[model samples]
Target: MTFRRQVMIILRRDLRIEGRSGEAIFVTVPFGLVALFLIPLALPLDIELLARIGPGMFWSVTLLFGMFITFRQSAAESSSQQEQLRMLGVDPAARFVGRAIASALLLLIFELILAPTMVVLYAPAAIPGWPAIIPLALLAAVGLAMIGTLAADITASLRSRSALAPLLVAPLSVPLLVPAAQGLESLRTKNGIMVPTMFMVAVVLALAVAGVVTAQPLEETT
Candidate 1:
């Protein structure tokens, strides 16, 4: 098969399996909702504070929740007899890219549901530019997918460490998160797309390139 066809095959297989299991979105959506609900409780119900922090809170909550789901999304596949089947049926590069796309799409779904609820609950003074937020979500999702998938692959072989996906994912994700945080914060203050958009895009591009390059040997080693 051609390279694009191989990638699509892996994508189809993952979506079908996730559809059957149903646990992936089951876990992700509620986690996102809880995270969204907690922000008001954690701080005083001060409108000023909420407005000041809402954008960051929105990004942080969604990103962290996404980390959880992205890590889980591929962990099962990498650990089982399915790993062998994947190896037989797909090239390692195709497998990695396909898995990344699936994880990114899942994250996007969570973001779509989470963002509007954040607007209603937190009542930000103004929503960020939709154009910018869309790209920001997409780029962050890609970065999260790459890093989360790699960490999941690393820990999947360890029976006891299955629960450690977040622990492993969060630290590595800071590079992505920092730029994202800054960008979102900028969105709070400004009208037009802010400078941090460039930083976030750069961070996502760098991590994605790194993930693609390192995935092969690491997949074998883990």
Candidate 2:
């Protein structure tokens, strides 16, 4: 098969699996909802307070929830079937790209739900600039997907890989977390899409490049 075909195969496989399951809708997104619901309660019910901090809190929780699903997505990439893919001569790099793309798309959907959910729950005053928010969110979702998929392989062989996935992925994801939170916060503010947006895009691009370069070795090592 051609390289694009290989990537699409994995992408379709992962997307189809997610569509059939709705695990995010029923499970992880609710976990994010809990985080969203709690922040306002824990902080104060003050509208002003919520408006100030809600964007940051929303993105942080969304990332956490996204990472949770990311582990599951990468875990599915393994087993006899994955070995079979390799045996068939699908480039390991292509497989990574494909899986990352699928996982990124999955994460993207998950975030799309969580964003509005946050707005509903928190009711922040400075409405997010939808134009900037879309790309910012896309970056955050895909960046998390790439980073998490690559990290998942580190502990894939371990019996404890599920538990270990977060531990492995979280530190590396600090760059994503910082810029994402800041960008969302900025996007919600009057200045709109400026420095933080650029920072976030830069970080996502860096992670994408790094993940692509390292994906094969990481897969092999695990």
Candidate closest to the true structure, highest lDDT: 2
Task: Quote the lDDT for 108 in model 1.
Answer: 82
Clash count (model 2, backbone only):
0
TM-score of model 2 vs. true structure: 0.88
Q: Where in model 1 is the C-alpha error above 4 Å?
A: 73-75, 78-83, 86-89, 127-130, 187-194
- Which candidate has the highest TM-score of all? 2
Q: Candidate 2's residue-wise lDDT over 119-222, tens digit each? A: 77767775545566677777888888888777766666678877788887778777777876776556555666677668877887887788778867765633
Candidate 2: misplaced stretches above 4 Å? Answer: 73-75, 127-130, 184-192
**Tens digits of lDDT, candidate 1, 172-208:** 8776677666665566567345555676678778877
